[model samples]
Target chain A: MTEAVELWLVRHAEARDARPGESDAARALTERGVRGARRLRRALRRLGASFDRLDHSPLLRAVETADVLAPLASATRVNAGLAREPGPEFLSDLASEVARSHVARLALVGHEPWLGQLAFWLVSGWSVREPARQPAWLALEKGGALRLRGEIAPGRMRLEHALDSETVRALARR
Target chain B: MLHLAQRLDELRAHAAIARVGADSRGVHRARATAGRIAAWLDLGGWSVLADDVRWLRRGLARARDLDVIVESAELAPDARAWFARERAAEQARVVVLLDDERFAALLAALAELPEPRGKHVRRALERMQRRSLRAGDALERAVEPLDAAHRLRRRLRRLRHALEWLELPAPVLRAAQTELGELHDRAALLGALERSPFERATRAGRDARANELEGRLASFRLRWPALRGELRRD
Candidate 1:
């Protein structure tokens, strides 16, 4: 039997407000965002969590946040697709990427609604097409990250652990 | 303006704490903030402040390097003690740098700089992207691929920083920079370990690690062409 692939979906840290006339992607991380990322890195270290690969969104906030966690991975990549809104294509692309790579452990650093939606899809096979049938949303706060394990399929994965920024801060404190 | 001001305040606060004691995190934050300020200056075309910001960041690099080694590397007690001493020395140097008259001058200048408008950020991104393409061309033509690759890596870093300012998507550039960064870290760590006196066990581990990184670097080099192509389109 093949080893179960572990996927960690991480939301970007808290970003500062976008400057006047600046695009959303231009918003960099705030001081709290930097601290939150570092704390999450420490917390993951405590859990003996290391990634085979880490991919992040192309946005400044996600890139900066992922930079803090780079030491835990052998290599990192930017995934432009990661910045896309949650939908069937996003799910299909992610699933195919995982299946193609066959990475035992992968970490993705991206934005919120997408991260939450991916997690929901993985765990419950939630279909975004049916908005009316949408179950309770699995919301991920800024600086939060969660682990899912099992097959790489849409509904085959299981949520192993979830850590919000605050929880990670507490864990790091210990 | 607010973001810059807030970061400047945070940098000062962290620097003050770092001066009081040998706090690695404080020093790290100060160093990071300095880099961010430099990036902002580039995006804003605040060329006058760029040199000072670069100088500040370089000054903090040594202490940050020592902190990282002390935190991450597995070393014998004797080697650990040696690093601890080196860290103390770096901390002292950091104190002097912070107290320098130039540091005050830089801060005053930074405070007066105007905020970067959207147009400036867009222009910087376009300019940096062009420069990166030239660097890529140089890499292809250079006799020594390794040297050229290193230069390209630095160029890509600046380009990515500019891209970040505009939130422009460049997966190829990001991947290249990330891989290059890891490659640099592994090489530096191996070099540092090799320069130190360690037991046979440590040397063996270092060799194993270096071998692993070397393999990865070779593969990354092989992928560079494809990456460069995608980056050009990006």
Candidate 2:
């Protein structure tokens, strides 16, 4: 078997508040968002974080997030499997893909519902449709990241640690 | 915009405790043990019964890695004592990583995924596929070079990893891996014997080791037709 994989799941940094009819995918990061993302880089280094590869949603905020945290690789990747309204099937496919990514440490920079639903499905194989059986939902704040290490196989991963934005800011203070 | 030096000062004084839990430790060993169990489901099934032993191995390795990390890091006196005790307790205890229920859960959940493998995943899978093909070609040569044969074994092992990831059937690749692995081991043993002091001191020892290696090599060759046939069938 390949080595155990580490997924550093991240939500994109703050973005400009949307304009009326402004496509969410076209929305760029605000100045504050950029600063927050740079801080994220500092925080990752502080935590001794490194990655073999990274992926992001095609949306602008997510792409910029990936650029700031982890520069885009040579290959153009498809969506990170994190839709704004992700469901069980999406998260399941994400895990299935993760299982095959073969990377020792892969960082996925994307959006919320993807990370939240993913957190749920990872800890418990059930999704929101079966919320009665789902475990606690993990909230990954903007500029926050969770370090997960294990099999990407459903219900097999253990959340090694989760750091909220406040916690990360605190950690990055020095 | 920043108070960077002070920030560094605060974090340098203390580190987070590493005693996450039994669940976090031994992930690799646990999954491998589970695989071994799955592989031997219909056989004598000692693999299933040996679950406790696998857990023990996992616990030991996790605790050791934890201790090594803590001992090597700078920490407050209080933190050091806390880690020392945790390490001691960790060293003394063991835990099972997977039960039959979780194993079945993993299989079931993954089986239901709706999408085809993602782009990065598929690229990696195709790379392994190509490598396995090359290995197969190496094995099919008119006079297979030992090095090429060794590569075939490595390629098969890699193909197994990819297949396992894809949840594809891998017994054929695994069987080929086992055969090539044994062949490599015997070849290595012969190399070691050739380098031994006793073998160097006596011509008889040298000749005996050569004969043993030749016998094993011939036996390994005898399996080729069967291996080729197996690969063809798969």
Top candidate, metric TM-score: 1
Clashing pairs in 1: none
lDDT of 1 at A92: 65
Binned by DockQ into CAPRI classes (incorrect, acceptable, medium, high), candidate 1 is incorrect
Model 1: per-residue lDDT, tens digit, A1-174?
344788898988889998899777767889999898888889999988998878777677886777788889876655666777667766566667667767789999988676777777778787645444434436677888889998766677899888976679888998
How much lDDT does each candidate structure score? 0.75, 0.56
Collision count for each candidate, in order:
0, 3
- Which tens-of-lDDT digit does each residue in B1-234 have in candidate 2? 122233223222211112233333333334333333322221211111123233323444545444443454333455446555665666334322222222222232222222233564556556656666666666556374567778877666655644554567767778778877666655554443344433444456446655775565556556666765675555
Extract clashing residue pairs from model 2: A173-B7, A174-B7, A174-B8
Candidate 1 chain A, poorest ten consecutive residues by summed lDDT: A128-137
* B18 Cα displacement, candidate 1 (Å): 3.4
* Candidate 2 residue-wise lDDT, A1-174, digit = tens: 334678788888998876898666667788888888878888888887887666566566776676677532222232535535666556556566656765677777778756766766666656545544543447688877888877665566788878787777877796
Q: List where candidate 1 sits over 4 angstroms from the true fold.
A: A1-174, B20-22, B117-120, B136-149, B167-172, B199-203
